[model samples]
Target: MSETGRLILLGAPLGNPADASARFREVLAAADVVAAEDTRRLTRLARDLDVSVPGRIVSYFEGNEERRTPELVDVLAAGYTVALVTDGGMPSVSDPGYRLVRAALDAGLPVTAAPGPSAVTTALALSGLPCDRFCFEGFLPRTPGGRRSRLSALAAEERTLVFFEAPHRITGALADLAAAFGADRPAALCRELTKTYEEVVRRPLGELAEWAAAGAPRGEITLVVAGASATPAQRPDDDALRAAVAEREAAGLSRRDAITEVAAGYGLRRREVYGLVHEG
Candidate 1:
């Protein structure tokens, strides 16, 4: 493959055009073809940067990504420097460019990137959480049960975690996170990142949950949650566990259901809860 026929992933400005890198402009103007998640947004961004792209511009987004990747791959293989950009942030990082990039790589085509602003890093930096070791969770499942199960699975994740949530679900998501990761966990809610009205609210997860419940904030949101601290060596006393189980059971939960609920509440394994219940 010719060196010129490479796939380049470009990270666009998250909210500020000034954050666009010099390399980003040079590559965008040099590509043989530009595939963007939103063609209109790409055009607008190009106008904003005053960069004229003399290449074919096409739409590639979540809905059409699977169907369009093969075509884009063909363009890359045909000696076209295919430049991929998302509406904002880094392409393929919770965006629509992963499939095309993967296909290009597998086909032995050269691939590269022009790094620019990213909401993930921006929010993490503003979060005041431990960013040294962190994980980007992208987005949570929309359904209540699926979201709950997903959060439950991440209960033991030790790295600080980041997530993008819509404004409307902010409160409920925070509540679910509190239930999964313990209310005392520290977190930050970053809104309208890099924009004129940007706001960052840092607090314990429990307090965030309460604040969200009062009113949903406007603008795009990014949440950074601190990981679990060292769990206490000693488990709750047998009487305490029994009382929790009994309380749930009295609230119409079956013995089995109450055991599960109490176990999750205390971050204990279900088997351990069962053993304790039986022992008492």
Candidate 2:
């Protein structure tokens, strides 16, 4: 209600028009300007809702977001309500509208949201995985090396992880996830949520990878993976610790280095491992 203007972020439906809220339609239809990731898709959505968007619709996507943010801010500064929406889900969540929102706030313009459905929460809830705490990793890098590096970094993350992936890359993504997290890691693949022919496959990473490789899935895909298990607090027995050090030593590490590495791995002091390894 500020005199400067308001930037309303509307959460579009994942794939169902019915998911759009009454306030979403009200704000979208009455806004002075609408910044949409895909104007065509927004048009279709408006049509589906039997609503008329009389505002000037402009394209605001990843490719053009940086360039268009200033212009949108100018409109907001002029005291015209601007509704920000993406192809799906909330704006600025791995989607467009982040720049404009930031710009609006910086310019002291009002900003708010009409929250709707989100694939992150939907998939997490339907995944049957622990959702008490979770993290949403919108999408992994498209490149193999980049994806592997990112996955490797997240291998030990303890919170349930959610990710968005393209239909075409699901195979390689699942494979990399399995290799990084562990083949037996439990994961759920939610595809085409809220749409006809929707699918939710819950399985181990290894099996999901194999299934993707066998046949390409064709829809928006959300992956929910169980977090890494916490390392047990119980310390290994002396014999086990000694054997661990010996295994590392056999792998070309010097006794001192092997003991150090083993100790760190087992959360024990170096001297303790050293003593255990050299014990009479």
Candidate 3:
């Protein structure tokens, strides 16, 4: 490491002020420079936690992170302890701080963390869905097509899934999820986590969609979706397939057309349908 000051990545409180760690407070107050996702939020948090920040505070959100990384790293390289924090949860978990952290590392500066509350893990813990194996898919795409395409890709995922969502679009997102993953797939909707109006709804996707449709819930939302069961569908017996083909034929369709339609509906190949329709 260079003979320079260390860079500290401080995890801020997710929702509750009390969730702020003593170490987080201590570091925030003692650092030479404090780079926050939102300066006003940082000040509010300082006042709430009663930790006076004596360091030079600067803004560092998505819009400014790119330009601020090198400046913060320069301060760190100048032998001044620079503290990085976000408005909620740890920096870089769907937030800023990656650029600064990387810049510090590239400059051979020492880097550390004062880990605090995290929305991702917090929501996952609250979700009654299986937690042993899960994936965090932060915020679905805004466009309808993009959102549905993303969900379709995850249709075969066997591990539970987590997602962050906006309150206004939660209803539409839930409906899309149900469409892509099926109505009966179990899920949990965690809202206003660690806040006064916190609510956790555990039910099937379809039910949740209906609930949201009636009235969209407000505040920060986290959704946990159960993964696919992976159970194979039972194929129809030869007799049953023949009976279905015969019915279709009796309805004015030829044998070939009947077999074709039935095969398409059942996701079977033409050869398979033909064998079933002709075999005893």
Candidate 4:
């Protein structure tokens, strides 16, 4: 391991600066170069920790990441320890710094982390949902149709799913999820994780939709949804499939759209529904 080059992937506190790990402070204090997603946020964090970064600090965010990575890579290759920090949470998890990490790894550079608070893990812990096997789904698309299409693709996912969403759109996102999955699906809404106003509400998707409708929530939001349950082996009978297609078609959906909707509802393949629609 010593023969390989090293790059530090530091996890910053999501909200509270005091949650920073001892290793996080040591690395920031001693690193030869610091690549931060947001230099202002990094500076504030440094002040919070009362640690001064002795090395160079450079910005590495989505807009200029491509241009900045090569320079950082050169520094790392020169045997200078480079530390990567995002505004909050772990770098490269729905945050900046993935490109640099990939570049470093492909070049056989060693990468390590100062583990600390993460919205993903923190939300999972606070969600009260099944965390044994889960997937992180970053943020969903903003548009209604695009978001719905994305949710449709994950309709059959068997493992619990976590998603980051804007507070303003939480209600609409919950409504869309309820439509894509079922209303009764179990889910949890974690808000302002690790902050003074942190909140976690566990309920069915339908109930969550209702709650969000009543009022908008503030702060960052993390949604944890229970996975689809195993269903009986028997396929939706032909009549059932036909009726589903008919119901959707009557609602003004095109034949193709109806098939997609019905198939998603029954957790069946679109082809299965198409076959039934034709047979009927």
The candidate maximizing TM-score is 2
After superposition, the stretches of candidate 1 with alpha carbons farther than 4 Å from their true spots are: 1-4, 231-280
For each candidate, the alpha-carbon lDDT, in order, equals 0.84, 0.86, 0.83, 0.84
Which lDDT value does model 3 have at 248?
A: 79
Q: What's model 4's overall lDDT? A: 0.84
lDDT for each residue of candidate 3 in 1-280, tens digit (9 for 90 to 100): 2357998999888778998898998998899899988899889989999999998999998998888888888888788999899988888888898888888999999899998888888888876556799898988999889999999999889888999999899999999999998876767799988888888886668879999999999988889887775652466888888898899789866676566556544545556878876775
Model 1, residue 126: what's the lDDT?
75
Report residue 269 deviation for candidate 1 (angstroms). 24
lDDT of 1 by residue, 1-280 (tens): 3544899999898878888999999988998889998999889989999999998899999999999999988888888898899988899988898788789989998999998888999999877566899999998988878888999998888788999998888888999999998886667899988778988887667778998898888888999987765563456788989998998788766676577546545656667878988988
Model 2 has an lDDT value of: 0.86
lDDT: worst 10-residue window of model 3 = 260-269
Q: Between the candidate structures 3 and 4, which one is better when assessed by lDDT?
A: 4
Which segments of candidate 3 are over 4 A away from where they belong?
Answer: 231-280
Point out where model 2 deviates above 4 Å. 231-280
Instruction: Assess the local accuracy of residue 104 in candidate 4 as a C-alpha lDDT between 0 and 100.
Output: 92
lDDT of 2 by residue, 1-280 (tens): 3467889999999999999999999998799999989999999999999999999999998888888899989898888899998988888888887788888988888899999989899999987667999999999999999999999999999899999999889999999999998876778899999998889887668878998999988999999998876772468888988988888778766675566446545545556777877773
Error of 4 at 77 (Å): 1.5
How do the predictions measure up, each by TM-score? 0.80, 0.81, 0.80, 0.79
Model 4 off-target regions past 4 Å? 1-5, 231-280
